[model samples]
Target: MEAVFSKEIQSGLDQARVASMKKSSRLRVCADGKKQTVLRMWKTGFAMEADAPDMRGMVDLYDGSIHLFRCLVVTTAEESGERHYEFKRATAVRGTPALDFETPEHAPAGLIEDAR
Candidate 1:
């Protein structure tokens, strides 16, 4: 499948990685505080390494719900040898597409505003 990331997002992902050393594990993935985040990325593969502090701890959608897990960040060379991350303390998550935008709807006459 095609990789799904914009140039800006890609750049941010790259910047998140720490410089790889001969025997250093610089990648860190952390669990999110919100339950919904854990529900969003399960099952979807992590072909490329994600940004730590940002993409870390995101719940992957496994069988059905948001489950927590961890991934090791490695260099491209290291990934080429073995690309799959081993998840631990995981919870199942259901994937959901991110919102593109949010805007106020044009109100019609007699429409009650929700903010009251």
Candidate 2:
């Protein structure tokens, strides 16, 4: 279903959208940035809000202060009117790894030799 709005109302709504985009657009798709808000993402690709940059190639997916991934991407298709890209090479940037060493994996036999 579609609803029509008066020109004044539509203009106001457009202004609001611009404001919302500035304040709430937390996702970016450049090298640690995207041109605009990312509407959807996946393991191998992502979709940005309508009329996204006419761009392709390497980009980084970031949400707020967190880095998501570094990927080589190309425009693929559109989903629900949003532009989509496929990741040719997507490497996860999930922060550093942690090793919770409760104990050593292999103990020397000499340690047990003196014991029962």
The best candidate by lDDT is: 2
**Candidate 2 RMSD computed on C-alpha atoms after optimal superposition onto the true structure:** 7.1
Worst 10 residues of 2 by lDDT: 31-40
Tens digits of per-residue lDDT for model 1, 1-116: 89989878876555444223212432223335432112112243333233222333334332233233334322232232123333444443335655688645974547676996
lDDT of 2 by residue, 5-105 (tens): 99888867765665565466677776434355676567778766556775577787778768888778888875445678888998889666765765457
The list of candidate 2 runs beyond 4 A from truth reads: 1-25, 31-35, 97-116
In order, the Cα lDDT scores of the candidates are 0.36, 0.70
Give the TM-score (vs. native) of candidate 2.
Answer: 0.55
Best by TM-score: 2
TM-score of each: 0.19, 0.55
